[model samples]
Target: MSWELVSGLETHVELSTNTKIFCGCTTKFGGEPNTNCCPICIGLPGTLPKLNRQVVHYAIMAGLATHCTINNVSKMDRKNYVYPDLPKAYQISQYDKPLCEHGYIQLDNGRKIGITRIHIEEDAGKLVHEHGDTFVDYNRGGVPLIEIVSEPDIRSIAEAREYVEKLQMIMKHIGVSDCKMQEGSLRCDVNISVRPEGSNEFGTRTEIKNMNSFTNMEKAMAYEYDRQIDLLESGGKVTQETLRWNPDEGITTPMRGKEDAHDYRYFREPDLVTIYTTDEEIEAIRQELPELPDARIARYESDFGLPEADAQLLVKYRKIAEYFEAAGEGLANKKTVANFILGQIFRTLVTDEEKENGAVAIPPEYLHDLAKLLEDGKIKMNLAKTTLDKMLETGKPCTDFISEQDMGDIDEDTLRTICQSVVDNNPKAVADFKGGKDKAVKALIGQVMKQTRGKADGRKAEAMMVDMMNDME
Candidate 1:
């Protein structure tokens, strides 16, 4: 019997605010275990909680970016739960009235996974089980979080991965969160189940708690899907429980039975008033939003003439996209700026984390100046590339490495003579290029570049060589 997979993701994004959601505690990532905490964040008595105004603004921004309808009025509720890491034994969150609803994140394959709700909540602390002893740290407690719950519209692991990726990209681009999975700023809980193919009715589903990385998410979901199908095939029942993914052992271990809404015992909070937003407020926030990834990607392709893959890669990270936009400002060849970043500048920051951090030392104007030289026909691409490497290495301008003597391209007649000499001297390379080894022309161009001291344009040199080859024919 064929079985199909069904899944939904509950993603928690830590807002990029300076303070905790309901207190003045610093929301910095790392500190001495409990040094960053205070009375209100740890729920001390006689201390009242105050909601951070920036948190609400960021939540609304997240809603607008994801195409969700922002609710004008919403209130906070106490979510009752017992946990060692939660100082209050109940987290402040929303139940019936959330900030955003009925949004969807579209995948690259044109599939829209419906987002159920995006609600603001407080984060719990961390528990470290060391040497069979448990230790708790309350530093992360009361941190602001926005829970993005998606409808069970995901039918495969690819959709699940893309959904998370799209969310990560959107949140980062909107400047609300860094969305770093490794830093615990972004987390996921996946609900997965399997049913007989072509069946509409849902089956018993188990939740996988806190998948941090894409590799783990994919592996855990695939394992759980197969596990459910096998159980159903053997006439065994699929249990509704929350499971922990053991990455080393590659299996899902049951943690506890799944709880419904009533399990939380939610109630309206007395300390906080209802959040009200006027049309003017929402519109004001809307106007503050920067260009989102999809829109920027489209403009990069349509206006800047970048390939889809290049445009997507550039827009994947906010800092890189910003740098590219600034570097390519008022330039005729925008792709040249992209090439400098993707080709040479990226080589300096070899890791994705480094690239995402935009660690390239050279300023955008340095690249813009170098590309400008290329544009004005004053410098060949080879010289521009070499000068860029120097600028990146020394944090100097292109003029620092390239002197006035090296600033001019060879005249057309002079370039024609160099090309003829290259063709005549490299008879074997020319024969190979004529015999259909297109890359063989590089050797001929190398000779011309060497003779001209890198002042000869490789493209024009190659074109002149092709013209020479045509004359021979």
Candidate 2:
């Protein structure tokens, strides 16, 4: 019998606060191990936790962005657990009284995936194991996190990946989180099961824990889906357990038995009282939110005349989208600006070194000017691309390089002279064009451009070359 996959995700997004959630320790990504920790974060004796107001504000912003209803009063609870990375044997998190609930994220196909809740919690420490020794770093221990739990509405691996990518884009656009998978800022736990097609009863589910990359998330889900289906088809029972995805081997290995909520022994924390928010405060935050990805995409398509695909690409990154809008403002042919950014500007950022450090060196104004030059036909596309490469390498304005190289449209007299030379030099090409081979003129125009160092206007030179070829005929 054929089976269908049912999946949901529990995403942990690290908030972009300067300090840890309940302590004054730094939340920076990389530092000397344990140096970013403090008494409260490290769970030292005699230390009390104080909540960060910014963390709450950010949580509310996240809730609002995802259409979640913000809770007026939420309380922190102690999630009792024992782990080497969790300095606090019992983690301070939200249990029954989470900050937000009942939200949804709409996929591009208009399918709405329901969100169960979004709760604020502190991150656990990092465990670095090398040569039979395990080292714990508390630098990330108290970093603020918002765990977004989705419903089991996801049906396929592609939907699972799209859901995560869309969430990453939204969070990044709103400046709530960087959502960098490499830095461990954004991570996911996938709960998936398989059931017979058209059956209401769900199969035994398995949890894939702490997948950091979206690609890995999809791969892991795909592997688990097959594993469950194959086991049931072979007359074996699917077990409920936690699994780890080995990307190197492309398989999911069983980690441990899955634990239910009651297993954690969750209870309300006594140290922190019930947190509260007012409608006025929520409204103020809602007003302060920037244009989200959806609105920006709509504006790009309707106002800027961009195709939906191009608009989606431009808005994929917040910084890139803002740069595109700033440079393309008041310019004719805004689509040209989009193309240059996605094509030439993106190509220049080749190496990771160039991408990390050299991207900001070349100003957006250079791109704007280059697009303008192309739009006005002052320089053809081939010359513009060469100048763009040099601009990226030297961080100089496009005009300065254009002037130094004397790059501009070749005069009509010079273009005609070059075309005549090309036609005379290739009698066979001239005869081909005259014999009704329309494409042969392109070769003659290419010769003119080569002679003029890409300074000749291609359309004008093509016309000139056709005229010169006809004269010989």
Top of the candidates by TM-score: 1
Clashes of 1: 0
Model 2 TM-score is: 0.91
Q: How do the residues 1-473 of candidate 2 rate in per-residue lDDT, one tens digit apiece?
A: 88999999999999999999999888999989989988899999889999999999999999999999999999999999888899879889999999999998999999999999999999999999999999999899999999999999999998899899889889988889988898999999999999999999888898999999878988898889999988999999998888899999999998864453238888889889889899999999999999989899999999989999989977887777888887787788899888877787778666543433335447778788887888887788877878887887788888877763455567778777887788889898888889999999888877877887788878888887787767763
Model 1, 1-473: lDDT tens per residue? 89989999999999999999998889999888998899988888888889999999999999999999999999999989888889888899998999999999988888899999999999999999999999988999999999999999999999999999999999998989998899889999999999889999999999999999999999999999999998999999998888999999999998864453238788998889999988899989999999989999999999999999999999998899999998999999999999989998988988988888988898898889999998988988888888889899999989898888788968899999989988988888888988989998898888988888789878888998987986786
> How many Å off is the CA of 29 in candidate 1?
1.2
Candidate 2 lDDT at 375 equals 83
Worst 10 residues of 2 by lDDT: 352-361
